[model samples]
Target: MSNWNGNWESFARDAELAAKERLNEVDRISESNQWKVIKAFQKHRVSDFHFNSSTGYGYNDRGREVLDEVYAEVFGAESAIVRPHFVSGTHTIGIALFGVLRPGDEIVFVTGKPYDTLHKVLGHPGDGTGSLADWGVGFTFVPLLGNGQVDWEGVKAAVTPRTKVFAIQRSRGYDWRPSFTIQDIEEMVGKLRSIKDDAVIFADNCYGEFTEEREPTEIGVDLIAGSLIKNPGGGIAASGGYIAGRRDLVELAAYRLTAPGIGGEVGAMLGTTRSIYQGLYLAPLLVGQAVKGSVFAASAFERLGFETHPTWNDPRTDLIQAIRFRSAEHLITFVQAVQRAAAVDSHVVPEPWDMPGYENPVIMAAGTFIQGGSLELSADAPIREPYIAFMQGGLTYAHVKLAVRQVIEDMHSRNLL
Candidate 1:
């Protein structure tokens, strides 16, 4: 009753079998992270009353207050701000940067250029878009070494007395490089502290939460931000973002989120409190499932002689799995195959377009229940050379396996495999 040829079927079987040990490792991490989240919930004494929504000024919203406390405890940060008001991960990160840096201050990225969206946020000098550069905040980045490691010498040379913040991006974003591990961040923190103890060390934690036992905050990161729809959402949080780190830094970000006088004291949960709480409870296990899916994807593609970052057995610090393709057509077909396997919108095919905030057109295969939630099964790529598709997230390992099979079968049908 199967349509696959013997060779393709054998490839699928071999890929799964090869990923057994890595999958087991992912499960262990899930167990540990799940317990950590449970303990945070217990420490906060979370109750049904805390899920109640608030309206108007939301002056005394206990649910909102407790959510912040729970996130802070979970991330091992001095304080946190969790709110539905943040439109996206980029917005949350923008708030953190703007809140901390004054007009004359500068932010130096230690992990090479950040994801494409942030380029606009960084803006150009006097672009007049109210972006950082337009507002007089300086921005620059130290390119990573050829091996994808941080360029410490470049970082040292880039730093100035005006460098108020040093940023580290935990995920690879659209790049074909290895995501930074907690240990790597710890080392970077040490190096940066030695160079400039007063500078604030910030982390862009999107697509990276719950993937490891400890977060960047635990390793001395001064601030961190991420979207709820990514790993922390558990594929359930409808919309929101969170910022966690030092108490003063979090408060400053909160001020930017609302108003300076109000700060975190007033955000209405708007009936999303319950789902957000439950989502945090489920995040660890769901993230583990996604990571397992990424491992399987890596193995499957590597077996086909396609290059993969953080190969199946390589240590995974995030859910993203990048697979290189031979041509633009091959990349487009692969992404379309991912869309075909989507449970929500299999009938809707995706195409490359001039999506905002990037230099080139991008194709995305979401078809997720939560619009742009990457924590659900999705694939995307910018239409560029040495074409690569970045795939991430699956609510269950089974869904990912099915999608991978469909992608292979589709490619074969088109004589692409």
Candidate 2:
């Protein structure tokens, strides 16, 4: 590791030193969120018995029930559903949307277009995949202004009597923009409420979990959803997703997760209860580590003259650290270097391909214990102009630091840095 050539080693060290203040702030947020999780656990009386698995109809699954309570408490929501049954973040968000929306109801995206993976779920009319559009739940987005702020006038123009839900994506996703902070979401909730008091405000709380002192639900978000394997998983949860918010909205999502009469009551834990519980317990600190990694990456990349969103000292509301590259080759090199630094699957090389649920070919470097676990160090990018790679997650800050050094060395060797 000491073999780093040129200014790479110094760049890494200087980046860490430069980000000290911001890293401390991240720690404070983590500490607060940690206490919040512990309080929730204490309030719910989590126990070893709750870790035991259930089978068949899974009636009287105390573990599952308590897990829900703990999540609801942590997120400051009236109710929650934590289930491995929901496959991915996109799936979880889809369930939440489908739960409360009806034919003729419309969804207005006040935060601009959501992540690319959700496009298919939104679907085009009559596409026949049974998407929301196919079900007659119309959807449209009011693009953000040039400054990446919400287009309030555009949102007001878009809302109609049919606008039943207003969606907000808490993360930057693939966009080269700032991730919305809790305060930002609160302001948006206020603005949206003034326009349509009855419309449900939904937040896609994907990579944003535990990154702030308060969650979107704590402000005014009527519903929020996220994947356990991302932030809340703490690199321990094998698989799962969660939906939390108003009691009625949560119940509606639960109905969509299972059946109407058997909402959140009948799903078998299948022995995943323990990790899920422990994952949530560790999520706050783990999320802090990931956020620190993001900051370090931003600082280090900025020193190397690359463009980074949410620069080193900028406020962090999510784990993603997007670095724009000069070309697709540079982006690919950066992603491949991240894979090389992985403890798992270090020998495998990543290449862009037509990944499902994305319009563009994509490349990903995910060498995680759990497949697609972004909580572990990983980087991915869609092959498009303004080539950018979105790097997120690190179970340990040390690993993230090492990955940055490795990326710098590898890219420099190829003359791409």
Candidate 3:
């Protein structure tokens, strides 16, 4: 705690103490996750030579091929397409969704609305931008029950003969509901299979990787996609995303990513192979650190009389920590203060307005090495009712601790805490 104690305002001293006590449980989970990563590394026989880069047509790119093999093995999938070309998690999911569904195919989201960026990909309300709907693919979602559980009856009524894809978002995205866990995803898979035997079950796995010991691919999901800059990036990968699952599905996604026949074979890794491999190697540890920070944030904010999701000791499914504020002013201030705590762009203040893909005006404190890296320390929220601030990512537990303390001190100085 020395890093925080030396300069943190005295107002946060009690919060720091309480946060430290709560860290014991976090440490237990992190330690277990650490061993899991080591076992995966050992099982795959990862070596320094595998970090070598490939160029040109990338023919016989053993390093690239082996990296995919390792990712597939670790994710418990038959195949994987991990590349820097897929710009974002949304892009990766788009490839998987578009690859599997035909023009007349219907896509059903059993997990309610997806992340905001996906709304554009799905062609919501038809923006005429070559979205899924524009391509003649149909979409519908079964809203979650009040308890955040899937409305099975509604899902049953929603599925049609043309329903070819059952999409599940493993993370909560901007939603207030709890993110789906591995067990929950497993149950959903069973239920979906019982209804539509051939439906391609896809999981948007962003921010949800390496948190649980087993992945969605390990359970029963047919395909899983995510951004490399999030959980699996290990705070080191500067760009890219990954999709891993059944070989046939991954092959289809690979075709969507590159071309009709090239698939995952021809893309040049450039100079990113080493970093991507290293990032995946370190992902479990980084995710654990982020989860710890989330726990600390939740615990500290709850002590300050704010409502927090998945209260401190609760099992974490993703890295996000949400604190519901009383008013929009409090939410904006909280986001601004979080930006101030950032090591990068601390001087810049964020304002809530219409961000590109969101419905509500969103404020974001994105101070990170990678432009939009959510696996680093950052906070953001939509300016709306409930006024919840969602904070996530910390490359290290200490940084997350410092950031959470800064938020408390900032609120206290304003007489809001």
Q: Which 10-residue window in model 3 sums to the lowest lDDT?
A: 1-10
Which of 2 and 3 is ahead in lDDT?
Answer: 2
Clashing pairs in 1: none
> What is the per-residue lDDT of model 3 for residues 1-417, given as tens digits with 9 covering 90 to 100?
122333455535555566675566566766776676667678878788877777788888878888888889889899998999989988899999989888899999999988888988988445688899988999998899999999999999999999999999988877788989899999999999999989999999988887888899999999999999999989899999999999999999999988889998887898998899889878888888888888877766776678888788777788988888998888988999888888999999899889988999999999999989999988999988988889989999888877776776776677675
| Residue 371, candidate 3: alpha-carbon lDDT | 89
| Residue pairs with backbone atoms closer than 3 Å in model 2 (clashes) | none
Pairs with steric clashes in candidate 3: none
lDDT rank, highest first? 2, 1, 3
Residue 75, model 2, lDDT: 91
TM-score of each: 0.98, 0.98, 0.94
lDDT of each: 0.92, 0.93, 0.86
Prediction 1 TM-score vs. true: 0.98
User: Cα miss at 58, model 2 (Å)?
Assistant: 0.7
lDDT of 1 at 175: 90
Q: What ranges in model 3 sit over 4 Å off? A: 1-22, 124-127
Q: For model 2, state the Cα shift of residue 114 in Å.
A: 1.0
